[model samples]
Target: MRMIQRRIRERGEREIPARLIGELVMEALRDLDPVAYVRFASVYRRFEDVDAFSVEIARMKEAEVPGGGDDPNRGD
Candidate 1:
């Protein structure tokens, strides 16, 4: 939770909205564990159907590859 706390501190605000906390959690989870990220996102985003889950999975898969646009250190 330190990372999330640091994110809030970095924002330099006394109060942060729930959305921002969720965003921080999503980002940290995505980088730390994709599977866990998807699980959390499914609940956090409140996916109504399987199509939404499929789309998120596809997006995460794309991000896993080099130069898929989520990384800046590719080919280094």
Candidate 2:
């Protein structure tokens, strides 16, 4: 939470973009907890169909491949 606050402060903007906040949350969860990240992302992005979930799962799988996923800290 403090990290996010610091980021907002550093931006020096009165209004923070929703995308920035989503990225921050995603980055934090993706490193610390992938499952939670995915879950949160689904809700944050408001996935109302199975297709959306599939796409996200595919992305995760792609990341699982060698040198694919951006974050090396992700667990199997």
Candidate 3:
């Protein structure tokens, strides 16, 4: 990604933090593709178990819709 590279260059730091790079990549991925975002998050977050992945997926699903996402009380 040229954007990521430009960002790192703008920082003007000899050593860049991995977390910053990961965050930039995540932002780009989120706008470009949902699946890619999740994939990158899994590795960037270093998910150790299924629960972690489940939690991340749930978060994304919730954010995808308004009104706090789908709910039984909403009567979909």
Candidate 4:
């Protein structure tokens, strides 16, 4: 977590690669309780609008579906 903060501070507005950050965060949360991961994700995502939040939720739901491409609202 300190490393993430340090990188952000040094990089200014240059965003950390999302995949790399997600891996790091997941590793860090490995030992945490379920609720802790939710808390961390909420803050890390800095969600500001319903549309953005809903997109993520939809992605998660899609991943969990039996047939991954079975989304009714697939095309946007």
Candidate 1 minimal-lDDT segment of 10 residues: 67-76
Backbone collision count in every prediction? 0, 1, 0, 0
**What's model 3's overall lDDT?**
0.87
Writing each residue's lDDT as its tens digit, candidate 2 over 1-76 gives: 7887898899999999989998998878877887898899899999999899888887877876787765567664
Query: What TM-score number comes out for model 4?
Result: 0.41
Pairs that clash in candidate 1: none
Question: Which stretches in model 4 have alpha-carbon errors above 4 Å?
Answer: 1-22, 26-39, 69-76
Q: Return the TM-score for each candidate structure.
A: 0.82, 0.69, 0.70, 0.41
In the range 1-76, model 3's lDDT, one tens digit per residue, is 9999999999999999888999999988887898899889998899999999888888877776787786666444
Output the number of the TM-score-best candidate.
Answer: 1
| TM-score of structure candidate 2 | 0.69
Off by over 4 Å in 2: 69-76
> Least accurate stretch of 10 residues (summed lDDT) in model 3?
67-76
- Using lDDT as the measure, the top candidate is 1
In candidate 2, what residue range of length 10 has the lowest lDDT sum? 67-76
RMSD values, in order shown: 5.2, 4.8, 2.9, 8.2
Give residue 60's lDDT in candidate 4 (0 to 100).
56
